[model samples]
Target: MAGDAEGFTDFATSCSGRLFRTAWLLTGDWHLAEDLVQETLGKVYRAWTKRSRPDDPAAYARTTLVRTFVSHRRRRGSAERPTDSVPDTPGGETDVALRVTLLGALGRLDAKDRAVLVLRYWEDRSVEETAAELGLSAGAVRSRSFRALDRLRAVLGTDADDPTRSGVAR
Candidate 1:
């Protein structure tokens, strides 16, 4: 029991930042991202205390986080509430603008599409890995990734042939 607690403590400390980043990308809200991470960590801890620990705790945590985000979106009352004003985020002008624009466009995506894009592009996961994590087939991952990119382009109003125009590098 003591060993499990110590191991989980170390694991959570090391991976929390990465988990928070993925959560933020998935949810596009700072507070919600924090809550998602907390919930994910709780689930991971519960699993850690079980008789059989996951072969890859980090991957398990990441999968748990993504699944939690997707399921939360499916809940009826989990819809986003609009704020009258945007909170200020500190960053350089161009970087901040591009980040905000991209996040906005991503936020407009369906939950599964957003999950596909984030896992495939932002996290740089392979199609097979993403499919496994999302419980989707490789073909479904590929199809969703392609269509999600198109949807992102449409939302950003950028030419499909010139993704750089949206300030995203290839």
Candidate 2:
């Protein structure tokens, strides 16, 4: 039990920056990223006091962050209207090619699909871990993952058979 406090300290110190960056990427807003990180850490802190392993704190945290972001989107999505116009870019100077491509592809995904893809690719979690985190069966995770990847490829205009984008090697 005493180790839990030390675990909290270590986990917070080690993973905070990465978590913040991920949150920023996920939310696309720096202020919201701070809120997400703070809220996620609070949930982590509560879980840490009762959790079984210090080494697995990050696993718990990542799951919580995904869950939190999904819940946030659901709560806020109801008030949002559909957009018909293409989004305006502020500067034509900087080449935002990769960012535009990735964000465009990601925008086409449902919240759950986005979470699944992000966890699978960005966080580099295995199918089993992703399934466990999302409370899904392994088969469901596998099916959804390929479907999500296919959608990403279609949006990115990449051949589905391409090895690099196939996500098998990388």
Candidate 3:
């Protein structure tokens, strides 16, 4: 009993940073990211008590995180659709600046597409795992991946299908 408690405590502590990072990438707001990560941990804690034979708690937590983000996005609807703050080009920014630009570009994409891209590129999940995680068909994952990359390219001021660009666009 004490061992399980300590194990979960350690798990939560170690996972919190990563979970928060993922949440921030998904939501793009610091406060919301904090809230979402807290909520995800709360959910994971609840599951830890009842869910047995849990293969990967982090994976389960990630799925819950994505679902929570999608729900919040749906609730916002049109309000989130307009973010005039993003710039059109990379300009004279440094690498961190370029990352910010890319993240803002990701913000313009559909929520599902954003999730697919984040899960694939950021989290580095394979297509099959992503499909299973998102409850999508393998082909559907491919399509979403394709379209999301295109939108990301357009947002980054690059041609979506230009082979000379990083494979992220082509």
Candidate 4:
């Protein structure tokens, strides 16, 4: 129906930016993040057309995006390979450097660990909500979140001596 299409379009327009941010965090590449958002929107659109509308379209889209990222990582023969040197960028700000460092550390984490951290910390979702999103138990989500933070801290080399040094705010 025309009304349904308009509704879906409006929803997509409003949520695309947030979805792209989550996708970018999940995938450390801009192009890949765009593709991921497109794929997620396609999935959501299909579901929207075929079934009754979901109670929470935003949450549905977020779950789909995260699941899609994890599923892609599970697949074999991914074409992406890390390059020895990054392409030159103009910014030299300290905040930019710290953000890049944090993203690099996140990229090094396992997909599930990255998902847990992004959902729990970056998105500021509760443990129960994260558990529901990631299809993990509450205890598992808590455990993974704790361990992932430790791994991230190790990667970022942020010790107790200088908590303020890490760009992440309390």
When sorted by lDDT, best at the front, the candidate numbers are: 1, 4, 3, 2
lDDT of 1 by residue, 1-170 (tens): 42489889999999999999899888877898899999999999999998888899999999999999999888837456523233466566566756677778888788999999889888989999899899999999999988888888888884433643445433
Candidate 3: tens digits of C-alpha lDDT, residues 1-170: 32376677888898898888788777677778899988888787777776472568888888888888888888885644635353333356445555666678888888899889888887778999888778899999999998788778777775433531443332
Candidate 2's TM-score? 0.73
CA displacement after TM-score superposition, residue 139 of candidate 3 (Å): 1.3
Model 4 ranges off by over 4 Å: 1-3, 76-94, 158-166
Clash count (model 4, backbone only): 0
TM-score for each predicted model, relative to the true structure: 0.87, 0.73, 0.81, 0.84
Q: Which pairs in model 1 have colliding backbones? A: none
Best by lDDT: 1
> Number of the top candidate by TM-score?
1
The reply for model 2, stretches above 4 Å from the true place, is: 2-7, 50-55, 81-96, 157-169
RMSD of each: 2.8, 5.0, 4.4, 3.2
Report the lDDT tens digits of candidate 4 across residue range 1-170.
Answer: 42389889999999999999899878787777899999999999988886576788899999999999999888736676533233333566556655666777878888999999888777889889898889999999989988888888888774531542345433
Colliding pairs, model 4: none
lDDT of 2 by residue, 45-120 (tens): 8767763644577877777887888788788756664232234445762536555556556766777787788778
